[model samples]
Structures are given as C-alpha cells and as structure tokens.
Target: MEKGKVVVLEDRVPKLKERRRQKANRRLIAYLSFFFLFILCVLYFQSPLGAVGHVEVSGNRHLTAERIISLSGITKRTSFWKVNEQNVEEKLTRHPEIKEATVEKQLPNTIAIHVREWRRIAYVYDRQTFFPLLENGRLLKQEGTKTAPSDAPVLVGWKDGDAIAEMTGQLAELPAAVLGAMSEIHYKPTREYEDRVIVYMNDGYEVSATIRQFADKLSHYPAIVAALDRNVKGVIHLEVGSYFVPYSPPKKEDGDETTSP
Candidate 1:
C-alpha cells in the first residue's frame, strides 16, 4: 500500500450470514404457509362444507323439477365428490321423454343437471283419454291429461301399430303453422288406399292426404290457401293432384234430386 492510498477490505462474513438468515426466514415462512394450507384442506374435506349444498335443474318442460331431481338421486345430504355425473345422466336418459341429459359439478358444493326432453308433437285420443305423443313417436299414455292439447292435432282413429307410429313420426316434421291449423286427424285405411287419411283444419278447410309425404305437401298449405278464397269453407286436396272442391248441396229439378259435381 502506498502513502495516502489505503485499500479497504470487504466484510464478506456478515454479508454471507445476513443472506443465509434471509433465506432461512423465507424457507420458514413457506413451510408454515404449506402446513396451514394442508390443515385447511383436511378440515374442508372432512366437514359438511364439502357436501352438496345446492342443486339446479334446467331445460325441462313436461317433467317437473322435483321429478328430475328424484330421478337424479341427488339430495341435500349427497356428497359433492360422490356424485357420478355419468351415472346420473344415464339414469335420466333412461326415461322415454328425456332426449338428452347433462350433469355438471360446480365448485364449492353446487351441482347442476340439464336435460333435453322430447318434443310433444301431437296428441292421440283413446278411451276418453288424451295422451301426448312425443316427437320420437312415443305415446305417453301413462302421462295422459283430461284436457285436449289444442297446440297439436288430435289423432282420433289411430291404432297402436307400426302405421300409427310412422304417421306420428311424419307429423313431427310438419311446420308449426301447418300443424297448428290441423285440429284433428282421422286414419281411414281402404282397399284402394291403405294409408288414406283426412285432416280437419281450424281454418274451416279439410285436407285429404296420405301418410306418405304428408308433411312435405302440407308445408305448401299457407301459400295455396293464400291464393284461394278463404271465405269459401271447402276441402283442399293435398294428394297427388292438388285441387279444391266447395261444399255444395243438392237441388230438386222436376221433382228429381240433382247434385253438383
């Protein structure tokens, strides 16, 4: 060392000790935090807080919420972790009315069940009871109601067979406007036309059609009716050859009764 030029030595021991102390403190803090979190997790899982606290249902129309819940086998005491989503969904879809089912588990003990039910396309009347017909061609006889479902056509003379099932399935494809206008459907099978049927419309017009291609032809009803005189309550033939014939009465000429063709 030269005179008036002094070299200062660094205090590395204290600096190293301070760094170790800080690292130890940080490690201790991390350990304590992990311990507390572990204890909280254990307590949370063992307590009722982990149990299902709330359950919600959606997308149900004909079936009640209570009915859906009962089918799901979920209650207030059910553990949130114990609910098997796939099992519950399968159970709900077992019913004929439910088209699809979805089950979801939400955080903090909430479960939700959403279901899509088959649409009620029409109603069939049998033995003084009116039963709803689903879009899947299933007749809900056990779920019959005393009142007629005016929203859909009432099938009067349909019998339980493949023909009626096929007919109802076809009716499901009809548009809302045309289906609403049809009040009743009569199934009349003849030797010439085995699938002959008649439809009574609410618009003061009767429709003569067959089960085959009935929905496709009926879709043109609005446009066809628009071109004709609505005031004349006649029969609209929606068969192979579309035509309209008014309801005319017979006349007596020279004491001989004559009818107009």
Candidate 2:
C-alpha cells in the first residue's frame, strides 16, 4: 500500500451495488417502453380513440334525426378523424326540405349534427294531394292524403320555380295583425299583371294587390278597416294604392251619413 493512498474495505460491494442500480434502471425503462407500445396498439385497434359511438342531432324540425342521418350516409364505421364534415353537411342540405345542416365531432367517439328544416308557409293543391309550400317559396312533392291544412293558407297560382319564394316573402312581411286576420292567398300569376295577388281576410274583407307592393300596402289595412263601416263588404284595392269599393248599398235619405267609395 502506498503512503497517503487510502483503500476502502467494501470496493467489490460498491461495484456490485452500482451494477444492481443499472440493472434496475434498465428494467424500469424496458417496462415503461413496453407499456408505451401496448398503449399504442390499444389505441390503434381496440380503443375508442377513432371510433364513432354517439350521434347527436339538433335544430331539426320537419325532418327527423334518423331520416337526416340516413340521408347523410354517416355510419358508426365512420372514423371521426377521417370524416368529411362539409361533405356530410352538403349531403343533408341538398334536399329542399333542409335549410341548413352543421356537423361537429365530439371527443373519443361522438358526432353531432344540427339541422334547420324548412317551414311550410302554404300548400299547393295537386288535384288530390296537396304538397306543402315552404317558407322559402320552394314547393315540396306531395307526400300524403291529407286534405286542406286548416292551419296555413292554400296557394293558387302558377306552380313553378321561384313562386314559393315570392309568396313566402310576402307572407313574411305581412303585419302580425293582418296575417292573423288572413284566411287565404290567391296567386294569379298572369302576363297582364305579373305580380297580382289576392287575399281573403278573416274579417270577410278581400285584399287585391301586386306582390311588388304587397307588404307596404297590406300594412295600411287595419287603418282602412277602422275608417269604414263594419257592414261594408267589398274589394279593398291596394293594387294601385289604398281604395275601397263598397258593395252596393241601399240609397239613403239626405240625413244619413254619406258612404265612402
């Protein structure tokens, strides 16, 4: 032994302990790596990480969820990460009955779809069955045997493209008071007067006007009715402007109030 050099009695013991520590670390790393690989396999094949399980639908009115989902062609096999949300929405919205559709992906395995359905503003009579006219003025194909719907008015006019849109615009602009008072809308589209429209009000008064000015003209109806006698039953011509033609009344003596035209 050299002078000033100290030797520890447990040299071999220290080396043995260091080798044990290294082995423990290697085992721990191996265990952690195995766990990581196992998790990756589970996620890749058996886990719900990419599977679709829940389908939530919202904002639908006319069309049911099942119908919309079927139309969209989205299935449980659809992978959430690989789904084309816009394509799904486009498929659902292609139908005239569907106004709008939105698709969203939830975590794990869930999907949500929100849809806005068209509103039926009127009905187009097809001899036996009447197809509903949506608020956008698009007419749907007749689906059933239900006769006149007592709820909304029946549209009688040239049944074709953009007709429903025109009618819907007019209906949307109608005053709540007049709309509540209206019974029917007679659509008489003609070359002589392209925008002609006639409506039968619940108060037994007739409204004849062009749709071009229908909204503005109909707004003055309550005042027009208020200024006239309740017994007056005739056509209120809002076609050119506000004018009332009374039904022929019995000629009265000079003392009676002079009736309006």
Clashes of each: 0, 2
lDDT of 2 by residue, 96-145 (tens): 89989999988766789999887666677666676777777666774434
Q: Considering summed lDDT, which 10 consecutive residues are worst modelled in model 2?
A: 142-151
Q: Candidate 2, which segments miss by more than 4 Å at Cα? A: 1-51, 76-82, 135-137, 142-145, 150-152, 157-182, 188-195, 202-205, 219-235, 243-261
TM-score per prediction, in order, is 0.79, 0.64
For model 1, what is the alpha-carbon lDDT of residue 231?
65
- For model 1, how does the per-residue alpha-carbon lDDT over 24-130 read when each residue is reduced to its tens digit? 99999999999999999888777889789988999998899999999999988788898999999999999889999999999989999999999887888988888
The model with the greatest TM-score is 1
Decoy 2 TM-score against native:
0.64
Model 2 / residue 138 / CA error / Å: 3.2
The 10-residue segment with the lowest total lDDT in model 1: 249-258
Off by over 4 Å in 1: 1-25, 248-261
Best-fitting candidate, scored by lDDT: 1
Give the clashing residue pairs of candidate 2, or none.
137-164, 137-165
